[model samples]
Target: MEIEGVRTDRLGLLLDQFDQAREMARVRLAGLGDDEYLWEPVPGCWSIRRRDEAVTPRAFGPGEWVLDKGAPDIPASEYAEVVRQAADGMTVAKIADDWSVGVERVEQVLAHTGPPEPDTSPVATIAWRLGHVHSNFEGQWEWTFGERKDPGLLVDFTPSAALALERFWASIDRWRDSVASVTEEQLDTVGFSRYPHSNDAECPYVTVLAGANLEFIHHMAETALLRDLWRTRFTTSG
Candidate 1:
């Protein structure tokens, strides 16, 4: 199959994956109200909050809305599972795949000898998940395709659901554009993406693109699940 004249090669596959993920996200986000967007299913959930209301030790973005992120507190069971996987000779990639997170994130968890600090990795609100996914696209677009300028502390964290959806869509478009513009030579080139968040600088561009597609796929699925939970929160099983 061909997409916009691009053959169904490696690059095409990546783009197709991204397109499908984006469409799923769009459908999942439709008619998302503000209350649902910021709904915290449990206490101490990390989410997009007003600067004054921020609870995390460190919050990113200069806007009135900040994203809460910290060293996630891994549950004892989860930590043990990682150890068990490692003992079973599972590669980092396999462990990461099982956890549905990036290898680097999995490595970080594995590097720790004990559980993380308390009040960390709280259940995240839909807003928080959307913010995280949007940030990845925005940051990668800035470093990879746009001027290799650092976005600095100027992240546009939107507190309103409507505005957040708008920004998220724009970011997706930018990321898709960047991926679509890559040439075969560029895909094989090292350091094709100057994205500072990961090992993109050391790996081939194709590796970076594939990793990003995985990120989008997993996060969007997670966000969709959150929406489902929100919709069914008040339902009775009887």
Candidate 2:
């Protein structure tokens, strides 16, 4: 069915670009080591570390389901930090290159990974950070493929962070197919998804999906930066 948006077929095109960006990011990060993967190039920059010694108050926030908050016009200092804070550094290589054989296996692995034992510094494997990053694209899948029963019903990982990742990723094909079937009318239909959304009686599905698209793009960008930092920091550490 034709999705109810700027155009019936435009959704696929839009998502294609999103997929492309994610794939590129994944390609770069596939073989990176954890130590290098966690490196942050900028001074005073945060990459995912434990709050050890409390020198800097490490902070992180979920960017899902939030209204655009909009972008800055001139890229001001404050605005740049806002953008940086909102971004979650992740590579596109899920499923195959990630933790397990299946998409859902990722969550299982994560679950096993367990939450930080407590008060540890924000390491690369931040408590909930990996899972949070994985879920960033979930809202889009739900909006395009199926509606999320509850936004809070985030996909959780188990058994060392593999559970959630594996489970969710296992269903990626299903998600892609589901999104392809979306109708434009359904996208614009208000109340189709949930509340606290821009389109109370509008095509929230499409809009959220659009946000997801942007998120996927962001993930790729983040991954690229992380991988680049990795290459720079340790590749030559002989």
Q: Highest lDDT among the candidates is held by which one?
A: 1
TM-score of each: 0.78, 0.49
What lDDT would candidate 1 get against the real structure? 0.80
Clashes of each: 0, 57
| Candidate that would win on TM-score | 1
lDDT of 1 by residue, 104-161 (tens): 8778778877544453346888899888888877778888887765554536887799
For candidate 2, give the lDDT of residue 104. 41
TM-score of 1: 0.78
Worst 10 residues of 2 by lDDT: 65-74
Lowest lDDT block of 10, candidate 1: 113-122
Model 2, span 125-169: residue lDDT tens? 221333445544454455434655444354543323234334534
